[model samples]
Target: MNTIHTHFRLSYKIYDEAFALSQAAQCHLYLSLSQKAIRFAVVDTARNKFVVLEDYELITVFTPLQVAEQLRLIAQENALLQVQNWKLVRVAVSNQQFTLVPETLYDPVHQFDYLRLHADLNPLQHEVYTYRHSGLEAINIFAVESGVRLALQGVFENQPLQLVHQTSALIRSILHVVPRNNLRSMYAFVERSYLTLLVVGPAGLEFCNVFHYTSPEDFIYYILFVMEEQKMNPEQETITLWGDITHDSSLFNILQKYVRQIKLGKKPEDVEYSYKFHDMFDHRYFELYSLHLCE
Candidate 1:
């Protein structure tokens, strides 16, 4: 059989957040190619009360008929309720760069990876999971650790970017580092003692970010203080910070710092799982909400 060897992906048209609706008006949208379509959209302003104008674009190497058939399956699963200001925008993407496999391929890989990774951790002290994944344009920097895993493009709007430069810089600044390479001081004790996750953004916007602090305590206390001052509890029930303060401001560095804190406070006692999901606050998650669109 002749094959196209084409890449596949599903682009979605997500509309504006609609006004709060009644329970009857609540709706969800999803897509499927094989047997069951997965639930991808759910407008739960209250309890599944709001709806939005969204559609799914299926990309594939299959014939047009195959694609249309898949679309029918999807529509049958999710009937078109109504219409709104939704436009179908065709974006030319370089599938060559990425495998661009059907999300069906990635979701399972991601799921298994998540469960397997979850099984191996310190459990006590380390109990959090969040990382800023790289955009489709660039690869993320978190594939090296035995205990760590990538959260990837899902952390934010499924856009190519999980963390924008401005958002990244905001995280860096919020951590209180000046972003200087030479200035970053890494104590040997800390390096030998902790795991590291370095987060890099385009310089100066590019890599000009460089700075160092006296101790990991400076960064740790700052984060704790920020949480406390803001009157918000750090989401994770327990935190373990096992790394040194005087290190790079990359995601790895910041995480190591936080891990050290977790160890000091939460002992991770009686937790079934040993793996920890350490995630950091990427300012972009909030910053992008403000802009509400790609510029």
Candidate 2:
């Protein structure tokens, strides 16, 4: 399905036989992002142009006609290619429900919540960077789009906190700079963005919540409440959370539990070439990386 992942970039796998891709698509273990499994898709490496948001598909809540309509609308803004094939699969997250996100309004922070994550690193070149979250006073929203960034401002424990994205990269092949000292150089390649809330008072920055909740119901309710408290409509909010599949996080299950149409973050690309379906989503990461149902 077309996933609007919160904590991931583009990932791909190669396919050998077309049938292999088909088989992979049918595997019951497709819902990799659950408390039960970590859904992962491999890219068709042979066609190596992965851009994280090139193309996407919906498996659980969409019908063939719906997919067609979605593609048609997307075509309204830009030319699009057709999926190679299509499949009927069900990803049932136990104790989970789903909801429909509004089609037009966009709350950038909620939309890119995942971008506000633990440090994202690029190892090939050994890059690393971290994003800190704090509520920005509505007055300072403009600072967010400015180019002067090294660290970012956020609300921590109800106070101001700052995170740096580094101004530049400095790598030295000779002299004293080694791989370990390539902080500036490595971070140069890391993609950077952050989510901040606007809560400014005469006093400085302050917004931290170290202790929230632990149970499934409490979690979902909390998240929903947070959204509502921020005056964000649950109907308009699209909550797509992605995390390491290994942890067995009940977070996804809880989220799916509350909403009417929760979107999972799995892709047909993860399947082996033989398992992948022909009419599945476009394998280009760039096209599907940010496919949001946000209206």
Which candidate number has the best lDDT? 1
Off by over 4 Å in 2: 1-45, 49-214, 235-261, 265-274, 277-295
In model 1, where is the ten-residue run with the lowest total lDDT? 88-97
Can you give the lDDT of residue 80 in candidate 1?
A: 38
lDDT by residue for model 2 (209-237), tens: 21134465655665566555656455544
TM-scores of the models, in the given order?
0.21, 0.24
Count of clashing pairs, candidate 1: 37
Which regions of candidate 1 are displaced past 4 Å?
Answer: 1-72, 80-96, 99-198, 201-292
What is the Cα-based lDDT of residue 163 in candidate 2? Answer: 20
TM-score, structure 1 vs. true: 0.21
Tens digits of per-residue lDDT, candidate 1, 194-260, equal 2222222223112111122346555445445544543434444233222222234453366464434
| Lowest summed lDDT window (length 10), candidate 2 | 166-175
Candidate 1 residue 53 Cα shift, in angstroms, is: 10
